[model samples]
Target: MAGGIEKLTALKVARLSKPGRYGDGKGLCLQITKTGVKSWVFRFERDGKERLMGLGPLHTVSLADAREKARVARASLIEGIDPLAKRHEAVASNKAEQASNLDFDTCVRLYIASREAEWKNPKHRQQWENSLKMHVSPHFGAIHARRIDTPLVLKALEPIWKTKTETASRIRERIERVLSWATTRGYREGDNPARWNGHLEELLSKPSKLKKVQHHPALPFAEIGDFFKAVKAEKGVGARALEFTILTACRTGEVLGALWHEVDLENRQWTIPPERMKASRPHRIPLVAATVALLKQQVGQDPTFVFPGAKQGKSISNMAMLMVLRRMKRDDLTVHGFRSTFRDWAAECTDYPSEMAELSLAHTVGTAVENAYRRSDLFERRRQLMQDWATWCSTPGVKPKTPIGSAEEVVS
Candidate 1:
């Protein structure tokens, strides 16, 4: 059998199927499982340890093909190289090449998909998709993500930077994020080309300089009492929710997403969990008499939501309160303007501390150091303030308890 090599032939390999490894000599073997599934394996040694490398299934890799593969592996072993390690290196290189070649459009899809779950709403995710499609995609989306450079980013942003400053700024931030994601995933490398600070800032004008600041139009604090009375007279769940929102001075999202379990009717409190809040901190609102009555009215309407939408098992839509304002022919006023209305009323009408008003609005008050030491939510003082607010909203022509010149020093 030629010095114990080439001991098995093609017919011998086909017939030797008794559930064990049969050698074809030169360390190449045909292995048959208990169920008669067969494949070729190459046995070798490197650094005093034994290894087996799979060739292919016996059905596809004939004895001749197996022998050729084994011969190449043996030659590698003789030359002080491990065939298995070399094969692994080749595979890794191929994968890295594939990763580096991923185009910008594909990277955007992957990046957005990865972050879709963390986003607040479908509209937010849609904004990411739409902005990139309209602005960035036309310029460099088909280019390899790794190959994206400063000029490419500039090409996408420059035309819109002045004419549509706010939109351009958002696109820049999003592009920076996608490139950063690509770098983390090994699809791209080098400093992010879309970065603003100390990078793109050198090329583009400051966003704040280009865009005008626009605040939501608010109803004058003096007119809020009449507005509240008009809103209370309106019929529907939205009107009730709007009434509650104004009295509590809450964000539209916070009011709409409220669940029955979050409300404590007996205690006159509504506890909004951190996840639902924009500041990501737990907020406790003291429910005044007006707010408690509003919650009571909503009880029989939905099993879960305090303000249920028309859809089964869903909360009220984000636009519901705004629609109520529009129906009242007050299209000039935004739902969020109510918070500013409350702030103005608290400053002009009440003797309560400014920090109390800020806290009631669920806004972060004072410096980080100040906040760290200030543990109190000032719930008791806040309760009294909210009661006074409710009284003001309910009673027409209520004058400021504090004189204009005698107003207490406001602490931010």
Candidate 2:
């Protein structure tokens, strides 16, 4: 029967029994608990076994929708699918749609959160904020994901694509990423408007010419040992952080915001929490003996931070290291350029594996599946690499001919 609303109201409220059908159908069991709570259930066969799906309160789905739902359930069964599986699939699809309907702001925030360790370049972070502010938020920041289309994304990109091509290109990529997330969840469908394959490239300028790549200026690798010698002549937490940052090959912010808790001095390691890392995974940095010495020397300090700011519990200001460089009359050198500096040294001076060098910089390995299988963080390989780095800094131009220690023994 096509149970109408009137018939729905006329149907008696079925009382619950002990985990058995209530005469309606096989899975359509009503269980009235000993405590008087009433709930509905549907059961069906799939993969040679039985399964149950819950339909809500008697007051909620109502007898009418319940019957209507039951019909859909039976129809699915006739097609050799389990009604319970179908119900869950439908719910998952709906949840995916809800996630897709998430606005541009929501998705990008997620995207940024996702890029925790990957976006080590300071400019990468700046462009994320700048692109959203200058291009995206101006137009579609508040709009829901389902409503986004080529025209809207083009509007976001067209104005600055020619003039600020670099940032514009990155903005488009981020927008595409957000829409792709939306599309996967069912908020939007069809080709991503932000995508620039054969479909989109015709409408816009070539992204390469439009985009300008920015590089952080680092002192030459030949100058690194001298740079550290100069760094030691400086004062305060900023100097210590610079020394540590150069030694570990981490970013400036990672060094500045260093909390005491993250440091495992006894283990000679620093574990950066996922929330603090650019890649959003907790990463371990094996501290060289020199770096450990710096920490222990400053242990009795008031600020719990490895580099405390003027305010309590706050990180040292961004300018702290910059000003340190300027005071040393090396204003031309940047705090961030030190990473490239380390990379250059590892490449030119050492026989370290390329992957080990990259990990020292906290860069991602590859696809998620690849990362899952590569369990080792190559700590021992890096320990020797870092100790070699310290020895290099301990001298001016003399390259060390041999590896420092068995990579594992450095832990002691």
Candidate 3:
């Protein structure tokens, strides 16, 4: 428009360009090429530096609109910003959409519906509904997803984080996930206000450090030596169940879901088929010496499970073992805490490799690339490690001391 742009004059820049783009003088110009294209270009010099930047082309854009764009760019330059930087800033700022007509309920419902089928278990769906009902829906469900900002998001999570840190952490994570979903689908915009990583970490205590989150209440690894002495002093189904858990490091649910077909005493392994695993993959748990000893002790038992319950095919209730602690007046500790107890002793008391420890816990080993190149599961190493873990736990008498070593909690 300023000079020679395919012979498009400043007076006719409006007529030549499209609805959304514009052109102006002062070396700022926008025009469609002979191929009916649209582009924004600015010709300018700053601090004795001259440069040209192509803004955009002119379909669905008008000449006057482009002139306004040029004015904004020039003003930004006067205020010590490069036009190119201003353009990127404008794009970023433009992401926050107006939400006068949006509703939070509909956004959450759609988010839940979109993800329901992908979740492996119904409890996943139930978790979504529970978070919404308990935390978000009560407050912001009536508001709009686009209207969700720092203060509103804080309101949704702060009360719960203050009182029930773990639940609040889940609710925050859930909201962040849902809001991210909405942003990609066009229901909202800007950075997620619910993100906890760099943003909310400043606002809230880490879930791991929070007392509510740490309350899985495990025995100190030092105390585990004494706990085993006490366990050997008493004998029953509950004691055996504790032995099985200590040997396998399996979740209470996974051990409960176990069946005779899954255990191969001959193979010395418990192949937890995919359906029983939280990860939905077949987990081959290498049987250690203690695990085999426990299974051999149960050989030819009438029940189908390696750890049998009073009922047929049902291993045992979670509460059955939990109640054991309650009866022993150690309700302060948890059944799942034994795994934490094992991890602590492995970390603080032994020279075991970190991968061996992780593999003993059945955790995925490395990064995707590293894992691709390193295919081995270190099965024998973990097998030996588990034997050592079980040996330490079931050790008869090491002068049983106070149950306190590595008091950190593990909640899975």
Highest TM-score: give the candidate number.
1
Kindly list the per-residue Cα lDDT of model 3 for residues 145-229, writing each as its tens digit: 8888878888888887767887787788888887898888888879999997789888877877766324467788767767766
lDDT by candidate, in order shown: 0.89, 0.77, 0.71
Q: Would you list the rank order by TM-score, best first? A: 1, 2, 3
- Assess the local accuracy of residue 35 in candidate 1 as a C-alpha lDDT between 0 and 100: 97
lDDT of 1 by residue, 1-412 (tens): 7878777888888788699988878889989999999999999887788899999998999988998999999999889999989999999999888867999999999999999877765788889999999999999999999889999999999999999998999999999999999999988889999999899899999988878778989888888888899999999889988998989999999999999999999998999998788887899999888888878878888989999999999988888998999899999999999999999988877667788889999999999999999978988678878887888889766677563322343222
Any residue pairs clashing in model 1, and if so which? Answer: none
Q: Please identify which of the two predictions, 2 or 3, would achieve the higher lDDT against the true structure.
A: 2
lDDT per residue for candidate 2 within 1-412, as digits (tens), equals 3433223232455533344335355345554566666666676767777777777877677666666676778788888877776667888989876765777777677767766557655677777877787789879988887788888888988888788887777788888887887777566678888888876789997876555566898878777887788888788888888898899999887887788989888889999988678877788898888999988987867547777778886888989988888888877778999899888888877666777888889999778899999988988768878888888886887655664344345333
* Candidate no. 1 TM-score: 0.76
**Which regions in candidate 1 have their CA more than 4 angstroms from the true location?**
1-88, 109-122, 184-186, 401-412
Model 2 — which ten-residue stretch has the worst lDDT? 1-10
Report the number of clashing residue pairs per model. Answer: 0, 10, 20
Select the stronger candidate by lDDT from 1 and 3.
1
Give the residue spans of candidate 3 off by over 4 A. 1-102, 117-121, 196-216, 220-226, 232-236, 278-281, 296-304, 308-313, 399-412
Residue 65 shift from truth in candidate 3, angstroms: 40
